[model samples]
Target: MIVLRNLTLRRGARRVLDEASAVINPGEKIGLVGRNGAGKSSLFALLAGTLHEDAGECLVPSVWRLAQVAQEMPETAQSATDFVIAGDAFLMAAQAEAHAAEASGNGERMAHAYTALTDAGAHDAHARAQALILGLGFRMDELNRPVNSFSGGWRMRLQLARALMCPSDLLLLDEPTNHLDLDALVWLESWLKRYEGTLLVISHDREFLDAVTRVTLHIERGKLTRYGGNYSDFEALRAQQMLLQQAAYEKQQAQIARLTKFIDRFKAKASKARQAQSRVKALERMERLAPVLAEAEFSFAFNTPTGLPNPMLVLRDVDCGYLPPVGASADTPPSLIVRQVSCTIAAGQRIGILGANGQGKSTLVKTLVGALPLLSGGRVEGKELSIGYFAQQELDVLRPRDSPIEHLTRLAHTVLPEGESRREQALRNYLGTFSFTGDMAYQPVGTMSGGEKARLVLALIAWQRPNLLLLDEPTNHLDLATREALSVALNEFEGAMILVSHDRALLRAVCDEFWLVAHGRVTPFDGDLDDYQQFLLDDARRQREAEKRARMQNGQAEQTSAVRKREYAAARQTAAQLRSLKRAQEKLDSQLHTLQMHKQAIEARFAEESLPVDEITVLGNELKALNEALDAQEERWLTLAEEIERIEAASS
Candidate 1:
């Protein structure tokens, strides 16, 4: 357990936290959320004891071990397992060596082995190590790979394994979901849900908070408020608070206006002098609610080209990857990361691709936009399609030296190239829509923060209202407010979208489908991710049920025959698998039904739209493009029929 009393942290003139008092109890999960500059990470550091608390007391249990992730890579030459087994590594090595020596049956070595094993707690260490390794995605084959050989993302996984391996009562995780794939993330969430220890995690991930934590600790307006529920509950409470504040502000303004008028009228009259004096005193004594909190401005407008398609994109057996380099010598092969990727995204379809780090989501997106080369594969057909692509590494695509205004200007030309004066005006108006006013628009892209850079990217993309939009991990390091804004804007837009992100809440909010990835080569599961998860839970339930049933059937589990035990185990496993498959098929059926309804709705709307507006004479090739999108979803549904049979059979 940890407690903070009257904690005040300041950075120069800015008072980040003022008189903040918080208590973290045993087995309580707390999610810390705030704006970009709200010092959530700074608060974590203060608690970690890496930074000094200028004003107050931090009471922590001495035995409460804390692990906070280091943003920077530390200098170390240890292997992956060595790094993960960092806590008391020497003892583990000594015990392993001692056990090996004792197995040889030598008297002197046996004496040494007994001393080492007893000191190292080797009797129970094997079980402990096994649980930790298996939980963190480690297998027997990968137990000894060098840590330096892995990339930064994989290195983070090693660090997390180390944190979990140590028997710490308190876990302080900062952005644990940043480098994790969907499977790893779900595992981490499941662990925290059942963990007996205390956790204070800082994350902007909606689903993570909703799944793991019961209490929401929000940092807003230089103070901390503890709300008694998940993110959705906190949001509802905050909305109520804002409404009260707005009503109070309005009432105060009316009272002030009335008092001022009375004072002016009575100041000149002798009979009302006492009343005037009292009124002035009252005005002076009234403490106006700490200067009304200003709402941050956000601006951006869509400048859509008139002649665009209804069906945004179409892919056919497309294999794509980044080129190694231009003009390279012979005997070099291109990196073909994505193989046989095909999908037809129709208007109003919000699709999200879920997968691990290297699983061709980005590659597929790049190929769709013509940014990467398509290998030997099928054709993608959709003419007169306008696309707005936002890659994860936006810095690579946008010029670093250019200002936000300059970026908008370039995009304006790309969107509407008919006239010069109208294009300039369009750029200016579009920038205004994304909250970029006069001088702020001139800020260089290189100098902006990650959030600012992402906002600018959105600004540029909205400047040209494309029929198809592609986004990659747009929620990384973003605050909840900005993400909510994106959710609103996307939901309102009349276009097709393809997104690649690991944020579960964002997926649930924006994407209608595409939970599974393009193929089976990326991250291994028990099989499919959703199916695997269902199977795990079902198996556990069945095992527990079978044990209970065996006890009841035999009148005593301890006295049961070996043949009966074997029979129960086999039946339990089979029953569990069938149950999981049955549930999975039901879910797929529901999803398919929803997809069909949405497609029908789209058709109904298309039929009712003014046909004269989409006339070939008026709209040119764009009308033909929109017509094809109407049939694409139906075709996709037909292809899924065969897969449905496989699911149904497994369940049976």
Candidate 2:
């Protein structure tokens, strides 16, 4: 159980939480939600023990083990498997001890160490770690690759995998779905459902929250409010609360007005003086109710295109991907992600691109938007066609030091009419429509939050009034309100669009059809999001079965008749030896267990009360000797296990 009592927390001069309290019981999955900069992350920091509360007490169980994804990028040469395995601290420590014992040539110690390793499930640790990696969209061949080899987003996924690898009592995940594709996101939703721990996750993805969380914790105006059920439920409940609050405030205001009028009309009359005085006192003593403030609503629409082009774009056997860099060898071939794609996107078409990560959804979008060159085939643009492309990374289109007005002014210069002069004031007014008002219009892009940058990108795209829009993961950094606004805008868009996003709500609300990019081909998907989810599950099952068969074949290939015959006689002798070694190993394990119990008892006694200096010194010496003997026995145990493994391998 976790409890926060009258918690007051601050970041610099900003008060994030004030007299806020909440209780999270064991095994409850909670969704922590708020607008951007509303202190969702700060609350997570407080729970993780990285940030202290300014006032009040936070109580978490002393025995609870917490796990969270690391924000810093990992720079290491370690294999991916080894890095993930390190998340299991207990297993890693046991493995290190077993290795040290084997080096010391203490047969008894090695035997005991092997027993401990087995108990920790060290034998299948690599397989388990690899499974996590695979589920996160890594290929089998990449398992042994160094951690430093992956890109920033892939490294973030590895970090998530590492966090999941740990056996934790409390898990804190902030936007875990940001770096995931739909397939991986679906898999993760299932994985999290099976987790046997308290989960506190902060995410703007509503569908993800709905699937994983049973409770919602909302932070509003420096107060924490707990609502039963998921995000949708919370929204509904909050709406009802706001309506009731508004009604109470209106009723109170009416009574106050009537009292004020009565006092003004009768205060001068001697007969009514006492009554007026009483009314004045009543007005003063009455509890005042503040009107409920509505949440900020965001709404914007794309500008109407200058011309609507029929058959906005056409791809005839298009090979979509990247070409070789300049100065490369003449023989270097182009890299193609999607090959022989033939499709026509007509005017006002809303097509959602669906695929697993690295399966060419972005590649196809880039090719269509002219960010990548087609290695072969043809791309036909319709008459008077204009394109607006939104990259998944906002930095691709936004300049860090440039203000929103500056960005808009530059864009206006290029697309403005021949006689129209660029006006800074006009551009500022246009930016205001997207929520960039007053000083915000002139703020440096470098100082803006991710959500701000995303809005800027959308504003820039809207400025073009293009007949077609190619959006790749456009809602990645947007909050729920902003996403709702985008969905509404897209629904009203008069242009054709190809959207690649993991945001199911936006896709469902805006897209009219779906095109799947898989296995280097583009094809129409005959079903909806739920069907796609089932498709991913079936694909994963098939892949697992295939891998199982491959492993079995590889094992068979390693064993031959001649080798088996030669090793059969040697195996019988080795088996007899292994039995004797196992008996000795079990005896050593018992001794080590007894020593551990004695050491623990001594430590507990010392912790409870003070001991005499002389007695403490004597007990310390005894504890040290016990540890040395235990190490030797563990080493002996490990040595025998290695010998048995070698014999078994040879016989196979």
Candidate 3:
């Protein structure tokens, strides 16, 4: 359990939490939400014990094991699997001790060390870590790759997987879905649902929070408020509360008005003097209800395009990818990530691109937008066609040192016809429509938050008056409010759009059709997001089965038919033994669970300090016996697992 009592926290001179109090019970899944600088991360730091409160107490159970994703990018030569496995401190420590014991030739120490390893589930740790890696969208082949070989986004996924790998009592995840695709996000949602621990997550993804969290904790105006149910529930409840508050304030104001009028009209009359004095006292004693202040709202729309071009673009037998940089060998061919792509995008078609990560969704979008040259096939564009493209990496489109006004001005210079260029004041007015006004228009792009940068990109796109928009993960850094605004704008857009995003809410709101990019092929997918999620699951299952088959077929190229028959028979016999051993292992697991529960109960009683000395001694001895028995069972379980692995390897 965690408790924050009258907490006052600060970051430098700014107060983040003022006289705030909240309670988070064990096993509760909480979603923390607020505006961009509302101090969600600072609260997480307080819980993690890295930040101290300026006043009041933040208490967390001393015995609870907490886990959180690392903020820094991991730089290491360790294999991905090894890095994930290292998350389980107990397993790693046990393995190290066992190795040391074996090296020292200490019989008793080796026995204890091996027992500890088994208790830590070291035998299955690799498989568990690999499952986490796969769920986070890492291909099986990439598991053995060095951690340093991955890009920053992929490395963040690794960090999330490692955090999930830990055996913790409390898990804190902040924006875990930032770099994940729809497929990986779905997998993560399922995995988190099955996590047997308290979870506190900070996310702007409403669908994700709705799926994973049962409670909502909102931070506003330096106060923490708890609400029952998910984000949707919180929104509904908050609306009702605001309505009631407004009503109460209105009623109170009416009463005060009547009393003031009565006192003013009858205060000098002899017959009504007593009543006027009473009314004055009543007004003086009455507490005034403050009117509820509504939250600030922002709305922006995309500018109407100058023209709508039917059959906006057509791709026939297209090979989409990037070419080698200049000065490279002429023999080097264009590297195609997607091939044989053929489609026609018509005016006002809102198409959502769906695929797993690294499956060429972005590449296809870039090719269609003319950012990359087509290696082969024809691309036909309609007359007066103009495009506004948003890249997934904001840096690819935004100038670091330039301000928003400068970017828009430069764009106007290139896009505007002669004698039609807008003045500086006019450009700033246009920027203001996207929420950039005054000094914000002159702020350096590099100094802006991700949400600010994304908004700036949208502002730039809107300024061009393009007939088509190609947005690749445009909502990657946007908050929920900004995402909502974008969705509304896209719905009202008069031109065509192709969006490659993992945001299910935005996709559902803006797109009417879906196109899938997979296995170097582009095709129409006749389904919704739910169906696509199932497709990804089915694909992952097939991938795992294929890997199993490949492992079985390893090193058997020259085997004769008779040898194969013998090996098959041996495999069947080994499988039978493994099944029997697995049943025994299950029974042992059940017994271990029971014994551990009983031991915990005993320890709890012992901690009460009310038990007699003799009784305490008896409880301690019983716990010792239970531990010994559990250790023996664990050792046996490990042996069975090793034997099964050996048989499977030999059969292969």
Candidate 4:
């Protein structure tokens, strides 16, 4: 158990926690939430034994092992698996002891050390580490790659995996989902649910907190409050409390006003002097209630587009991926990731991109945003098309040396019309709408927090008044309130949108359709996010099984006989057949969907009273034809799907 008794903590001159106290029992999963800079991180430091309370008691069981993700980026040549396995301190210590005993030529000591190493599960360490790595969105081949070869974001993921690998009674995670995609985030949620330890996480993602935490611990105005249940429950209960508190305060103010009026009128009169004095005494004895101040509200909306271009952009058989390296030959063709993706973006259409990490979701988005060149196929834009893109690494586009006002002023020059005012004050006023005000507007962007940086990028995008928006991981650094505001703004946006995000709430609120990028193809996802999550889990399970089988095969003696070669050839043929059938099934499914939609549209026209008898007859006949086509496509789709299933079953 951990206990805090009237704990007071400070960072520099500011008191982050003032006489705040809370008790956390062992094995309880707690969510530590607060507005940005509300001392959540400070509290985590206190628990991690890095920061001491200024006064009062902060206690944790001395025997308990603790684990936390390291903040510093790792720069090592060690293989990813080895780096993760090193997280297990106990196993490492035991192995070191065994080595030392063998070097000393002490048989008894070596035997004891070997026993301890086995007890620590040294034999399965590699497997466990690899599982954590793969579950965090790394490919199987990346397991042997040097840690430093990965990007900063992937390195952070490795750090998280390392923390999870450590054996601990307590685990502290801070913004764990910041670098994860939806697939990895879902996998992490499942993993955390099964962890048998006390867990405390600091996150601004409401859905994540709701999913992982059973208890909510909120830090506000230097006070710590613990609530029973998840973040949603805490929000409901807190809102109710605020309402009651406000009501009580209003009633008290009314009573105080009445008392003052009575005292002022009668205090001077001789006959009423005693009564006036008594009223004054009553006022002095009353306990004053403090006004309930709401948290600072932050909201912004996208400026309505000057023109709504129907079918803002079209990608025709586009092969989307990365271009060759800078030093490579100019004639070299781009490496294709998603092949032959054909999609149209119309006014008011909202599309969500879903896929496992490294499966071309980002590649497709980059191509659409015109940041990456198409490997093949042509891209068409409407006459009045205007695009605003928010890349996953949006911060890289910002000039850190420039202030918000300077950034906006430069944007105004390029985006705003000539007649529009580009004065510093006007730009400052505009920046204020996104909560950058006064000196903060003039503050250097490099010194701003991640949330502030993200807000600035959004503000820049809004100023464009684009009819089409492409956003990738836009909510990564935003707080819950800001995310809610963004969701509301997006819902009201009349522009077409393509979004790639790990935030399920945002996806559900903004997307009208979903496109899945997988296996070098872009296809429509027929179901919702829940279905996508289940698909990822199933895929992960299958991949693990395949890896196990491959390992088993590798351990066996090589079979070079003609019979074995023939068997392998037959297996490859079956696999190719399965792939072809799946592609055919996808095509038929798309055809069926189109026919069904056409049928529904025609049927809906029959309800119109303005339609004449002849028109109704024509619509009825067209609907019948659509239904027939739909039935035929559906039958073919089912047959192909069944064949795919059969092939899959045989392979398994």
Candidate 5:
């Protein structure tokens, strides 16, 4: 169990937690929630032993192994498989021991080391790492790619996979779903539910929290409070508490008001002076109850579109994907990702895009937004059709050096009427509606956090008075309050909308129908988010079974052909021998590739002069050992290739 006894923690002069206390029992999957800058991450830092509490006690079981995703962006050429496998500290240690024992040629030590390696799950480490990588949305073909080849979001997914790969008694995940698509989010939620260890995750996705967590730890006004159930339960119980608090505060205020009135009326009269003085003392002695100050409500409505265009946009026989590379031959065909995407965006329609990652959800959105041209299709737009597109990478379109007002001004020039008020004060007032007041309205876009930027994008979109909205993962960076606010705004948006989001809460609140972009086709899904989740689970199960069968056929091909032994003995023998040789060759190739990645990482570390002398020396020794091992592995690989070639030639 973990206990916080009147814990007081600080960041600089700000006391984030003052006499905050809570108790967390073993094996509890907890959701740590608070407003932005409310010290949720700070509390995690404290628990991870990276920060110390200013006062009181935060006691955690010392025997527990803690696992957390590193916040820093990784820069490495290591293969994804090796990178994730390296997360298992115990496995790494065991493997290192085995290597050292083998190098020393100590038979007894080698036996012990090998046993330790098996105990650390070295035999299936590759499979486990690949499973995590695939579960996080990486394609099987991309499993062996260098880590640095991926974009920032995909790299973060790799980091998450690495964290999940580590065995732990306690796991801490911060915004684990931010980069994930709905498919990956579903997979992770399922994985966490099955995790036997303690979990403490900080996320704004209420549905995810409700799905995985049984306990809620809330931080408010420098205090920590624990709730017995999930986020929904916490909201219900908190609302009740807030109501009770408000009622008590009102009653106390009334009594205080009556006492003050009596004292004021008779304080100057000699006859009542004694009574007045007693009342004064009584008032002074009273411990006033503070009123429950609810969080400020944030809600906004999209400006009524200039014109509501029925059937805002239409696509027929659309093949959505990327155009051929620059300077390509005129005969070259476009790379089609989704084919036959025929759809219509009618007024007041709310549609959610559903599919696994890389299943063309974003591609379809891009095509609808006119960011990608249809390979072979007819696209017709209504005369008054105005699109408010919120791209997944909306920040990239924003000018970093420009303030919110500047962004709005540029947008007004492009989309607003010719003579509309583009005045600084007017823009500031509009920005304030989205909570960007005063100096915040003039803050540089580069300096603003992700949620603020997302708000700015929405502000831009709302200003357009678009008849249709195409939002792709708009809530990725929003806090819970902002998400709820966005959801409310979207619900009130009197226009056609096609939304792509991993946030089930936002999806449920905004979308009336769902379009499943699967198998290169667009089709209407006949169910809600719950049914979609089950469908995803079923699809995943089927894929896993298929993969298992493939592995089995590959691994036991020779053993499974006993019935054909007599009639096709020679052919079967040759085929089995070739298959065995090829498998060995492939295994050797994977090992060599992994080793090369490690060697490159070491070399890159060596290039960094800031490393300590002792660390440099250690790296040098490791590099030398790696080189020797690589040489031996290369020789074996060469031998296997030669044998495979000889067998193939003989069979031919």
Candidate 6:
């Protein structure tokens, strides 16, 4: 457990926290909520011992451990497993020391060292480490890869995996879900649900916090207030709190007015003199409460001009795709071909392309935009044909040396052609409109995050306000809050959009039509993207049910082939072998428990005997080894339990 005893934090001239006291109890999962610069990260760092509170003590038990996501990369190369193992560094060091003592002719020290390492789970700690590593989405083959080879995002994941590996009474996690994908987020949510230790996490991911945390500690205007319930419930309760505060303020003001009138009328009277002074003191002492504004939200609305051509883009007997460069053609694709393929996209057409990986949805868009040449016959037409393309192509068009503002300032004039002076001023103001406030406007384009860079590029393009929007996975690397803002903006947009995205929710919200590209052909469908999700789900369900029925009826109609019979027998034998192995593991675990406890007993006796400091140190080594062994056995049991549960569930 960890306790923040009257903590005070300041940022420059601002008081971010003032005498805030909070307790994080064991097994309690908490969500830290606050606006930007409300000291959430600072508080987390303080808890992690990476930052000083300046005023109050953070009281944490010696056994309490904290884990934080590394926003920056470490110097050395490391793999996913290496990252998690780093969390076990303390125990690993103890292990090495225990072995060294045994070699140095100190039998008591050797015995004590062995016990401490064993108790700390050194015997089979690798399996525990691997399990924790795998839970965070590491492939078995990636265990040995250098951590430096990973991009910043993957490095964050490695940092997170290591944090999860650390067994601590209390854990503080900051923005834990920022780099996580939906699937990994779900897994981590489930893991936290079953975690026994106390945890406090600062995350912008609503669904994640809702699923995992029980307590919401909302930081508003540098004040800490705890709310009971999940995030949605917290929001509702916060709204009620705001309303009540306003009501109280109004009641106080009304009474103050009455007092003012009474004092003014009775000012000349002797009794009124004391009463007026008292009222003035009350007014002076009253802390006037300011209203808390709602979170910042983006407003999205755009309209297409009338008198547009129908069937704007069309392809006939054309293959739309590109192959990697061949021979000396550095940037040229081999070709993209569609045989007897015909397609037409008209004004007001909202389409989504659905296909497996490696399908040419992006290629089709490139061909339409003239970024890729059409291989066959096609006619494309649009009235005044203005288009805005937001691709996943890295937005590498921005010159790295130039500031974001400088690049954007140049693009506006170049793209608009006749904008000249007035438009440049409006464009500068527009960049500020999208959070490029003052100094941020001058930050180098290369220095921005992927999400920020994408938004900046989109801002420049949107300034022109084109008729067509071609977006490809625009939500990648964006935090959920930003994604929500983008959603609102897209909803207000009126231009025809051709979107290719893996986000079902986004596609459902924005699209009115669906397009499927496969085998170099185009298939158009009526209705919205929700229909596509339904179709996919329904198909998957039907396939699953069909497989279940087939499996059940296998013996009735078709006897198993000899090859299948052999496979079944092999599976049964493997299951039996695993069961036998599980029993042996349980037996070994029981014996190991006895050994570790005996070692602890010896160390405790040594501590009570008032021996020399060196003798006590020898006993301490034994205790450390004992702890490691216990951890290792516990880890083994967990793995066996999981394996057995899975096998039983699958059979059932």
Models 1 onward score TM values of 0.72, 0.82, 0.82, 0.83, 0.82, 0.66
Candidate 6 positional error at 407, Å: 4.7
lDDT of residue 419 for candidate 3: 54
State in Å the error of residue 610, model 3.
Answer: 39
Worst window of 10 by summed lDDT in candidate 2: 643-652
lDDT of 1 by residue, 476-593 (tens): 7567777778877877667778888877667777777664443433322233335645654554456557757777788664545987798668667766765665566445544544
Task: Quote model 4's TM-score.
Answer: 0.83
Q: Which wins on lDDT, candidate 3 or candidate 6?
A: 3
Distance from true location, Cα of 565 in model 2, Å = 31
lDDT of 3 at 432: 90
Give the runs in model 3 whose Cα sits over 4 Å from its true position. Answer: 96-112, 266-274, 417-421, 555-652
Error of 4 at 644 (Å): 31
Q: Tens digit of lDDT per residue, candidate 4, span 1-652? A: 9999999999999999999988898878899988888899899999999999999899999999999999999999999999999999999999999999999999999999999999989998998899899889999789999999999999999999999999999999999999898888987986886677899999877888888887889898999988766789789978998999999999999999999999999999999999999999999999999999988978999999999877789999999888888899879977888999998888899999998777898899889988898889999998888899998788978999999999998888886676546888778888999999999998999999899999999999998888899999999889888999999999999899999998898999999899998899999899999999889877877887787779869886665689778977998899788778777865774576467556646766887679998998888788888878866886776677667666755775
Model 3 steric clash pairs: none
Clash count, one per candidate: 5, 21, 0, 0, 0, 31
* Model 4: lDDT of residue 190: 67
Distance from true location, Cα of 297 in model 1, Å: 6.6
- Local distance difference test, per candidate? 0.69, 0.88, 0.88, 0.89, 0.88, 0.70
Q: Candidate 5's residue-wise lDDT over 1-652, tens digit each? A: 8899999999999999999999887777999998887899999999999999999999989999899999889899999999999999999999999999999999999999999999999998998899889888888789999999998989999999888889999999999999998879887986896576899999999999998897799999889988767899789979999999999999989999999999999999999999999999998999989999887766667998889877889999989999989999999988889998788888999999999777898899999989998899899999889999999888888999999998898877776566647777787888889888889888999998888899899988887788899999998888899999999988988889999999999899989999998888899999999999889878876887687678878875644466657636886787898788778866875687578668867987988878999998999999999999988997897787677667754653
- Misplaced by over 4 Å in model 1 are 74-77, 87-141, 290-305, 320-338, 396-402, 409-429, 437-439, 518-652
